[model samples]
Target: MARRRWWELPPAVRGAVEERTGPVRCAEPVATGAVSELVAVLHTATGAHFCKGIRSSNPLAWMHRNEARLNPYLPGVAPRLRWVVERGGWLLLGFERVAGRHPDLAPGSADLARVAGVLSGLASAPAPAVDVRPAAVRWAGWVDPEVVDGDTLAHTDVTARNFLVHAAGVAVVDWSAPCRGAAWIDTALMVVRLVRAGHSPERAEAWTGSVSAWASAPAGALDAFAVARAGLLRERHRGSGAPHLGELADAAEAWMWHRLPL
Candidate 1:
């Protein structure tokens, strides 16, 4: 999908944002990600802050509110939300513009260590006592329901692009798919992407083992997760050229092949 630029927003919406931030001098849109209709760095005389928004009418509009709600409780490693504003049928959020590059989760990359550190911190985060559906309920059709309950807040969409490796540490961004479930769930999600990035299933599992939640996960649960991921990946084959769709499909097959009972 084509990304909308700063100029694309209605004048009323831009004016509303300018009311809080000073006259916008620069609104450079980030050149990646399909989730946001408008995502850019708004530069003022003082400094720059990250901004991303979607129409209030869009189905994913609630994610903006969800991110705002979760930001206070999210681990310190993730960028914090600065403000949330709604105007002219759009919901926008300003974030603590973290400086970083996308993490390289390839098998031999130096950034793998940093990725592990981020996952470890995130594993221990307790879900704020809010009402978000559990992972089991969210992926109920593809996974065993019994193995999905937990209290840890999960960043279930831990694709490689979601993590930014910076000087301070690895920072997670894009809180679009926040879920409350087993902490291992995020690690499991990441493992698939790792495999797609050329890590063997054995190697990916070894990397995941560094995270306590992944190490403590039940064997039965992991088995079910492998099968579930395979099934879900197949279901997501939209026949469109989405990012990493084919590689993930292959990873899914590899995971299921390795974990399925012989």
Candidate 2:
């Protein structure tokens, strides 16, 4: 589970990126994420650009590529993709740097409203014509047996780490997990994170209702998502040693508790 640092990247990979952005004045390795092999910012004459990649042999390399392909369709939600390079057995992707901080999802944080507003816009974004897994297929074992479906492109990973609060607006970064599903799926995903960050089930559900798709979603589908997410999180908590996993599993359970009938 060790991560590759900025200096550890192949000279060819760095050179390939430099071809687009000029010399890397400084390369800062970002230590926040878990999945990707590399995540960092390259300081250049123009400005800082975020970059990340994984080894070609790794099966998840396709995920890095998928983000590059999904960038244009992401519209204003994500930072613009600058360039992508496949070199030295790695897939490198560069994105325009946005000056911002992660939004606070804690109780009473003003950002709750802004983040909901952003999710509402997603109702208007249909899945682009690309070969991507549908949410039902993607979340198969964990979601309802009914295969909850939709045409809107959903940013399945709605964790706080991905929402960048900028002077421009909240830019939802990290499109690594794009799924075609009910537009409301996004609102539900965000509500999970909201509950993780300490929102009560009532408050979290209230925030989700602000989004049209969520407001109109069939009660059965939402109930199914609740149970399925709790089941998935419980399964994850059992396998992982991370302390936070238990807390997250508990949060998902809280949401499930709100949905299930006596």
TM-score to native of every candidate shown? 0.94, 0.94
Report every candidate's CA lDDT.
0.83, 0.84
Q: Cα lDDT for residue 183, model 1?
A: 75
Cα lDDT of model 2 by residue, 1-262, tens digit: 4689878888888888899999999988887676788889999999999988889889878788888888987868789998998999988889998778889999899998889888899766888888768888988877763546888888888888888888878898889888888878888877788898988999989877678788788888988888888888788888985777778778888998898846
Q: Give the distance in Å from residue 145's predicted Cα in candidate 2 to where it truly belongs.
A: 5.9
For every candidate structure, what is the RMSD over all alpha carbons to the true structure, in angstroms?
1.6, 1.5
Whole-structure CA lDDT of model 2: 0.84
Q: Per-residue alpha-carbon lDDT of model 1 for 213-252, expressed as tens digits?
A: 8878998998888888887777676566565776798897
